[model samples]
Target: MNSGEVIDVTRDAIVTFLKVGGPMLVVALLVGVAISLLQALTQIQEQTLVFVPKILALAAAALFAMPFMGDAMASYMTRIAERIAGG
Candidate 1:
């Protein structure tokens, strides 16, 4: 592939990665921020209090987002394969 094609492929890979992982990360970040606020307000600083909810929220978000992730990966792979075959 030429430089332009290579850059395009790399950009697609990055976008796919962000599309797949971004939601859960965003959810975890939001949860952590909210938890921090709660801890500050209530003065409860147990580490598990932060860890467990973040994990649970991330898991739930990932589970909910799995279909979209799969679709995006499949779409990217198909485009890549087509480019390879054509080139």
Candidate 2:
């Protein structure tokens, strides 16, 4: 409830967010970079070429990462609820 508590909660929220979302983000970034490199090498400048692969990769990543993401979010929520109850 105080400034320190608020800072701690905010910091935890950010860490939880990164933990839950980092995999998909990294997947997206890597896919995008790879696609860009392939396009550069092949001289394929089609702007729409990146979408399908990135989408598929991100979907697969999300699917594989779902359980970990869920556990992280659940833990974060539990901690927040405990703090609230304690206060």
Top candidate on TM-score is 2
- Give per-residue CA lDDT, model 2, range 1-87, as digits (tens): 799999999999999999998999999999999999999999999999999999999999989999999999999999999999999
Q: Please, what are the lDDT tens digits per residue for candidate 1 over residues 1-87?
A: 789999999999999999998998899889999999999999997877888889889889988999999999999999999999999
C-alpha-based local distance difference test score of model 2: 0.97
Local distance difference test, each candidate = 0.93, 0.97
Give the TM-score comparing model 2 with the true structure, all chains together.
0.98
Candidate 1: where are CA atoms >4 Å away? none
Task: Assess every candidate by TM-score.
Answer: 0.94, 0.98
